[model samples]
Target: MSRTPYTSATSQSAKMRKDESFLGRLGGTLGRKKKSKEVSELHEEGKKAINAPMLPPGTDIHPEDTLLEENAERIMLDPTSRENPKFKDMLKVLIDWINSELEEDRIIVKDLEEDCYDGQVLQKLFEKLSGRKLNVAEVTQSEIGQKQKLQTVLEAVNELLRPHGWSIEWSVDSIHSKNLVAIVYLLVALAMHFQAPTRLPEHVSVQVVLVKKREGILQTALVTKELTSTTEMMMGRLERDAFDTLLDHAPDKLNVVKTSLITFVNKHLNKLNLEVTELESQFADGVYLILLMGLLEDYFVPLYSFFLTPESFEQKVHNVAFAFELMQDAGLKKPKARPEGSL
Candidate 1:
């Protein structure tokens, strides 16, 4: 084949085209880099907008949902098994955080369905607010993230323990978690206290009540001692009124609840004349303590039948009659048959 004469101009034009192609590739790469940088800047601006001044704490957070709403939603959205290692690790860390802060030992997320558990948003917010890609290690143990969580937990725990003269010293590694066995042990501890002897005070003016807080958190208070639950429970107007009446009666030493409690006992026991009015008339606290102690035996015997047997109301009262010393059952008094209800 006869070849056409190749010109220097053609050679130069081809070379120029090759150079242009190289320059075009370089410009494309630069354009992509510029786009990525712009995206990052916009993301930062979005974060700043989100972090703008907001409602104060205890401000009614969005229609009463958990703090962990998004994390859980993400998990549910992820199509990963609950047993997935990454998901489990997430859960494990979260559970540790929650059980530690709440002072409970529930091992699974299902257990928290009843309470305020909104960690997902808070967690994702951390990544967004930080503008950092968090790896598993960072997500679980990032000092900044954990510190934020710790501050929140400290505030809640301090709030929980304030009335009880208890406080949690905040730290990354806190002792809020209880091994499953330890949880069982606490119940045993409570049992031991009941079975153990008591240095029954001459009288006691203590009370405990279960209550639900404004944030759907449940707690208990010393009802007779503090009457703090009216606000803490965030009770409705009428409920507060009723609580006011109930609380009003308790601290005034005219405990109608216990008075009616005595009447209920007398009716059931078929014992002669177990009078509550007599106890109320004198406003005797020591006798009231003994009476309530008697009532506890009836209340508890259903569960602790092995230790406390069902007995007549009179008999129950007699059971708690003697002083129980920690070292030994001291001053064991005989059951006195009261023709009249002195206590």
Candidate 2:
């Protein structure tokens, strides 16, 4: 049998084919790399075009006048202002005051923006404070209806404030649009004007962002301003009558206050598998108070020192007095509250 002999011609042809295949693959890889680089460059160029300055060169931009335009929208409170401790405290006080005033009507205001945008709460608050109800709807579900109600309510509120020589700081459109700064301003003004028996924080300030359109271009400015200074001054001008306690002037407020205290107490007590419902009756026994003190002060109260289940008024009073004494021993200022008062 004759076998095919390996030849130089055939070997040379195979080597050439291999070299051509490698060259084709290498060329394809380089082409792909070049195409990727071009795409990346185009992407960078597009980003640069988007981020470029809007105004043409040599077009003068007056910072103050642009921000002060009548059509300018105060967009939002600055993050620094919204997160400020004083601002949070002021918002709490304002919300508590509103809840205290409207508690009897079963109107609970949890958020100033979400709740007041519909104008129902504001109208009720106005009627409750001014003792004059406007001819607005009690509740409106539609945007148009809410706007109409807001217009009527704000107009009446402005009228009420005008007689006191104070101009309206918020507009109907602002409130209906849920502008928090505008809502806060309106609520603060109402709180001060009505002298809602709650004490408002003085000299609170916040930073706001104002946005305006000039020549079809949007411009923004950061403005820092006092929210409560004017209200504080107005409050100061009023007569210095002795402020009535919440229990005396507004008994409904006492219930709301009691509920809040109970919630706070329960939050701490829940760790010990305890809950508080009625503060007056529950704390009257002084058992919860003693436990609360021990938990808060991080000290173990001797079991023998106080009654766990006080069956009589005298025993309850003893437990409360012992708790107060423990507080005093811990260098805590003795509360002006009396132990017998709880009993």
Candidate 3:
């Protein structure tokens, strides 16, 4: 101020720096005090919130265990409120639903052994030893051939059906969905013939039948009947011996029937390669027709019966009682041999 030699811009900068440092130090001290007070207040609020329930005027629930108790209760009560059905019955329904929706899927299994099903070795024996190749295709084409194939599949199916005192037969209506309808029909028939528990829902029925038939084209139909009703209260599970016996007695009729059909078709086609005949293609068509028929008999129709009414499920307990009076019938006959023993 007293003629200070007129300070340059650099000197002014240095003075300003010293003043700014002093102000910064003072501001820092005040800021720290304010932050400490704010932190203590927040800590007090948190402690109050946590202990509020235990305090003079807080919620009744204890703060310490609230979260843990809530999680445990949720875990315990959740499943009971949902899906109330017997495990077996639920599984059956699910399987039936899947089978119904997936009706269009055609299942085919192959085997080369002649005796794999229905004494196929014997069939081959007849072919090889008969001098003339057995014209399976020709035999399968005509109405007679179709019937014969049906009979063959039936025989294989009976290998399973008979031991449990179950029987299988074609429906009179010639329905559609050979696989689906047939299974339903089989179930119905078993229910009708046996004294077993109503394994199938009372309103449930399966119908697999022929909707239409053309030489090379066949239309099939499959349907399941279901109704809601009070489930019949039953006792303990059937004896393990009885259940196992049923399964063991008739293990793989469906598998046998399916394999037989494939072999029959393959054999016929192979025969066609060796020699030409007017009826070769026609026979091939017949084989195909029979294949479908066998499928209906084996997989489509019989499955319903096995699931709906089987010996181990106590479906055939009385054999002459409950089912007969309450159900519509289908398969009822036993295997019969012709008087002359014609093959």
Candidate 4:
């Protein structure tokens, strides 16, 4: 009877190791899944808090008009400098004014509709830059003229940027998820342009396409105020016209931005390799836009604090802004909020 004593150190050890590995992997997978689910749940909560466009059948015309100024306060309280020195400060001012008064955008959404406005602007600017004729929607002010679209879907994009205002939107499509996807398409095109500058290179240029963008002050403040349209005021012309009128007389808060922008640009031009003569509007659109994008970046913090909004939109805005900011000749992150005592 040959009975060999079983070795506890060999087979048993291997089985124990296998179980550990499997459990470890299982824990890791479960951990990642939980994090992702938590993030998604938080995102949906934020959207539910402040999310929109044309009135849907179940649309709440007046679903809690109370928006917190916490976002503004947070930025204002922080004396520390962001990317640009005045970035956070200016954002505080813009958010402050937007909440304090509500003339054009009575129903101010804390979400990221400003991206739609920017997309429209970018579409027009690209056409001009590419030496193509401005599209009908880009050139015409009259909504009636805009009625005739670009013939076919293949002819041009026919996007319905809802949560869009009745106002003639001329903003940077910096942050909204819908606009972020749109901006990604635009960035691919922009990258193509930059990789070649004038034309695509025959060989690899080794250009880096950085996904993260550095945001400034104004882009954060570029909130969309979808004017509640009624049967009596359904005319697009009238709606846009009213918006234009609102712009004619700048609120004291916005006026400060114009002044500050000039001073900031004038001082920073030499560093930018742009001479005083080259600082005019037409030539300096690149610089101005980069700076404006920064403003929005700055404004985003305060804006997010208001609704517990997700940082995804702000990150995308920063990504695109960084892309634009780097384009003078040629020349852009967020944290989640937790309770005071939370670990």
Whose TM-score is greatest here?
A: 2
The order by descending TM-score is 2, 1, 3, 4
Residue 308 local lDDT, model 2: 95
CA deviation > 4 Å runs, candidate 3: 1-142, 167-183, 187-343
**1-343, model 1: which lDDT tens digit per residue?**
5444466678888999999999999999999999999999998676435433331222222222223322221001111222345434433434443343233323233332222222332233233323443343323345455555534543443453345433222222221221122221221222122221211111112222212233333222223322112211211211133435657666665465566766765564433234444544432223333334346445322233222332354444333332121112223432221112223
What TM-score does candidate 1 reach?
Answer: 0.25
Residue pairs of candidate 2 with colliding backbone atoms = none
Kindly list the per-residue Cα lDDT of model 2 for residues 1-343, writing each as its tens digit: 4334557678888999999999999999999999999999998676436434543333343444345444555455666677889889888878887897799999888888899998999999999888896998777889999999999999888887877766566887778767788888888778767655445567888877666655444555667767777443756534343223565687777777777888888988998999987776888878998999888888888889999988887688688878877777889865445465465
lDDT of 3 by residue, 7-53 (tens): 67668989999999988998999899999999989986775565443
The per-model lDDT (C-alpha) reads 0.35, 0.75, 0.35, 0.33
- Report the lDDT of model 3 for residue 284: 29
TM-score of 2: 0.51
Clashes of each: 7, 0, 20, 29
Error of 3 at 196 (Å): 16
TM-score of 3: 0.20
Weakest ten-residue segment in model 3 by summed lDDT: 334-343
Best by lDDT: 2
